[model samples]
Target: MSHTEQAMPRRAGQQGLWVLVAVAVSLALLAGCGDDGPTDLQPDAGTEPEVCGPSDVWCKDQTIDRLDLLTTVSTGEVREEGTTSGEFLTFVDSRAGGLSPTMSYSYLRFTPQGLTPVQIHDQESLGSTDWDLAVRRYTLRVNSGTSGPSCVSVANTPEGTTFASVTAVNAAMEFKTEAWFDTACTLIPDDSGLNGPLTQLGGFWAYTSCVQMTGRVFVIRLADGRHVKLEVTSYYEPSAQQVCNQTGSVPQPSGSGAIRIKWAFLP
Candidate 1:
């Protein structure tokens, strides 16, 4: 073949190779920017993630950059005891070193049927919006303010208002965040069992030496703006029920930290 003819064919082959490489580069870029890509890619700092789903419900607003450690924190097993009055009834074994000096919290998310346990126990737990509530023995915390960065908050009903009675969230009802500290940054203690520090659902259980349900119902506003009415039904198992009398002593004290709660979505 002539030299010019040979050079033309080689140039054509080189052009075809370049076209193939360009196509592959485009595909790789598309794949990297896809929705199912790795979570390591950081977005703008402090930028809130977009509201997800067709219903615009909960936002998977986990700030990957804010977390110092990416290790998976441990959690305990959760039990489903079925439903009660169109509400979900769940039993959480939150006995992670109950009353011990060093303890851990069990994180959980609310579901229509029951509570789904979320295993995130490290610094990443505070930055992730996957969990709605965290329980450590008697104390409880929601994902907001000092607790985390999701928009979860709570509003308490009247003194005698039952969970079933709270059909809708009134416009005047004030929503409060999970506050574990006061204005001076001092750690607020649950000394009175009434949550003097202004925690949203802190008063659900009262401790007068003996733990007992205060029968308080709270309407929790979830991250997606949906409301749920929740109440702590029992602190012990149903088989071994115990409550303090007029005095603060329990004659037959049942096993503690068997947290049982009943909750349902509100209108």
Candidate 2:
């Protein structure tokens, strides 16, 4: 069955969704080290009715705001499979190095068909020869926006307006939760490319200090074209140095945190 067909009819008041963490024994997948690009397999863009009635599962009576999802710190183990209450697939970055308090990555795979999320070890492992298992993916660039708590944003695109790989979303204007949405089913895409938000010197995913991610917001585009706005509400783990004595020692698990998000399938 297709993704849209599998979407369950849910209301907006759902809260306190707990995400369970699973440790996979698979090897770590390094980034920017391989030739494999993002998977080209796009989910079937099933059509939605022009007018959604109150009982339609695909229709949103009201846009859900500030829904919280929890993730455990990255313990060097891959979050091979997990699902959020929002029905979004969440995963941890399975790189071998210890999770840097300042630098870390995770992913959200949007499969409307209720497909289980997969742990991606590296770029080359993104797509398989088997067509049915292939999934479209994006990199989660976790960082502090402007001068607030750590915010979650996408690294591939500079802004959420147009889909591109070279530019990143502006940290100043587009990095806050309020900037991504206006109301139910209404979204304003970030058209400002270099002019939108600016990241720290090393870029969006670059880590500076332990408390750098305290406040920020991130907007991500799912495979099915839905937009999710995210904010890092809290951190549940300690710094990498605090967890591991030496950089070489098996780094302590780190990336887990609390995320508050607002999502909708806008036209």
Candidate 3:
């Protein structure tokens, strides 16, 4: 979905919901190293709801017995997959990553009366959350008005005066617990380009990838007082000396260059 089209339905009282931004850059894709100028894969508009694949969206290892927590992947992967309405799809800043919750954990559901936008650092624990969804509980360090403690949260729950809506702001905190790995990504050259130096860089950069971005990451205060951050966030910085080896005497011992997303922006 487009950025501007994203809507908020949470009631106020809560301010500064942690929102991660994922911005990937592809010089090859933008440079037209292939046949098509842009990857013409028609992004399924909200028009025809398609099937929700498990990977499309789901609570990993979550028990379906609880009922409405989540539906089948084919049930609501995207807006089109589910019913005709747009409520089934909760599209956050995915330029972010996946946040899947397991079925064996205890979670709290809150319905607010008003929802407003505010930025905060630390707040009260809305409730004990389990990203892994195991028996372990993680403290929820909310973005309070003043960057408060590791736990606690503030909310604008249906006072009636303000236009309010409630949302599971911490769903990702309840799931998507994988830490960012600087070594899990790589780069590939544009071989489709018959030009001079274009073919030489093909796949030559995969082993030379040095960008590690844990975009939209946060130091969340868990139920136990421990702190955690989400993956594919801005805090992720890959080691520079971990990519391609042009020679036995490479200057930095590895590549330390961050990948460029033609239209990248700092979070």
The candidate maximizing lDDT is: 1
Off by over 4 Å in 3: 1-68, 71-214, 233-267
Cα misplacement distance, residue 79 of candidate 1 (Å): 1.8
How well does each candidate superpose onto the true structure, as a TM-score? Answer: 0.67, 0.29, 0.15
Clashes per candidate, residues 3 or more apart or on different chains: 0, 23, 57
Alpha carbon RMSD to native, model 2 = 27.1
Candidate 3 Cα deviation (angstroms), residue 100 = 15
Q: State the displacement of the C-alpha of residue 91, model 1, in Å, after optimal TM-score superposition.
A: 0.4
How would you encode candidate 1's per-residue C-alpha lDDT over 65-105 as one tens digit per residue? Answer: 22122344445568777546667877877677545513346
Per-residue lDDT tens digits for candidate 3, residues 69-102, read 2221111111111132212211111111122432
Tens-digit per-residue lDDT, 1-267, candidate 2: 666555532222222121111112122243442546453544334753222111211111221121111123223332323244533333333332333232222323334443233333222121211111211111132222221122323432233333212133344533221123343544333332322223221121213233223234345533322444443322323354333222322233544342222222223
Q: Sort by lDDT, best first: what order?
A: 1, 2, 3
Please report how far candidate 3 places residue 255 from its true position, in Å. 27
- Candidate 1 backbone collisions, by pair: none
Residue-level lDDT for 26 in candidate 3: 53
